[model samples]
Target: MTTASDDQKLASWRAFLLTYNTIMRRMEQEMQDEQDLPLTWYDILAHLDSAHRGALRMQELAESVLLSRSGLTRLVDRMERAGLVERHPCEEDRRGTYAVITNRGEETLFQAMPGHINSINQHFLQYLDVFDAQALLRVLTKVLEGERPAEGSQAEVIEGDQ
Candidate 1:
């Protein structure tokens, strides 16, 4: 039992997936070519920079960056060697480690930010009119808040409130 609305919804979902993959690849390639830095590294640096006192617990960072704990640990090891980040044993919680951004990390992020902003503007923002932008934001916010795309759907959206 196919319906026009269901077909349209599936088409929209496909479009979203395609656009996301395309934009991410472009962002990654541009970052690597221009800065000699991987997009994953940039993402970690940016997340760390935004955290309180430029630090976050390893688990929190893993969640923030959408990386598994083991994966993040390996990446953080590399970053530490590069002087981009440092791991400090938490005073209050000895078992927890905090990933803190270094001055060098901030410098790197600051340098990369302008190009990133330009890329986002060029590839994404320019396509959205004000109304479209607002609508997009609202819909995304709702989705992030565990909203169902269709009424009567019982699916759960898994997202942490960061």
Candidate 2:
């Protein structure tokens, strides 16, 4: 037994899900084809390249990449093994660790930028007017600021909050 309201909500949710899935799949494919990098890895490198001193505290890196801490640690482990990034002790804080992009990581991002820009333009920017893009930024910011699970997700780690 389904009501019209339920059907409408379902439709709306489906639209959101499909949008996310399609964009991620296309972005991943484009990055792989042009850069030999996964989108997630590129995101990490991009964040580092734009960061202060091309490095960030581990917790900060995880939050910036929108990954749970453990997830980020695993990602970093893989990147470290690939020679794209390295982790070192934080100078100011003995308990803290920093993720620093290696020279290889910088080169990887440089190689990826043109393809990334083209993909972004084709799949994202060209579809939106400037006004819409600004509005979308605001909307996404609001969503990011929203509350998370009180207990946090299982995959989440209780490290320093970002």
Candidate 3:
């Protein structure tokens, strides 16, 4: 039988999942209505736009966008067909491939930015005060860092790091 603490933790997890889903759905609808862009496509474009030379290796892009390799491959194929991105063979490694954002992709990203920011502000950020935002960020960062493997930790490791 689950104890009271376990029950409370489960409830909290469920609440977090529900809130995440609700916010994502609202943001997706807002983007679809206002910008005609899906959140997933925007996420991929945003990552590419921020990367050096507006490009990233396929594996890195998959990790950045939290998609499986096969899933990312299919999505990239679609984006390429849509004229939003292009695939370039890596000069360093013949086997490696890079996804480079096209001029059209950059234009689309710029066009979608305002609506995305507005949706975020309206659906999420408006609810947070400075302190709440900071606390939430800190807690989420800690959780994410903790989830990383010690061998390949993403956060910096100090002398006394756990």
lDDT of each: 0.87, 0.85, 0.89
lDDT of 1: 0.87
Please estimate how well model 3 matches the true structure, expressed as its whole-model Cα lDDT: 0.89
Rank by lDDT, highest first.
3, 1, 2
Better of 1 and 2 by TM-score: 1
Q: Write the per-residue lDDT of candidate 3 for residues 99-157, one digit (tens) a residue.
A: 99999999999999988888888988999999998787676667767787564544443
Number of the predicted model whose lDDT against the real structure is largest: 3
Query: For model 2, what is the alpha-carbon lDDT of residue 95?
Result: 95
Off by over 4 Å in 2: 1-10, 145-162
Candidate 2: tens digits of C-alpha lDDT, residues 105-143? 999999998888888888778989989977766655545
Provide the lDDT at 117 for model 2.
85
What TM-score, over all chains together, does every model reach? 0.88, 0.78, 0.89
- Which ranges of candidate 3 are over 4 A from the true structure? 151-162
Clashing pairs in 1: none
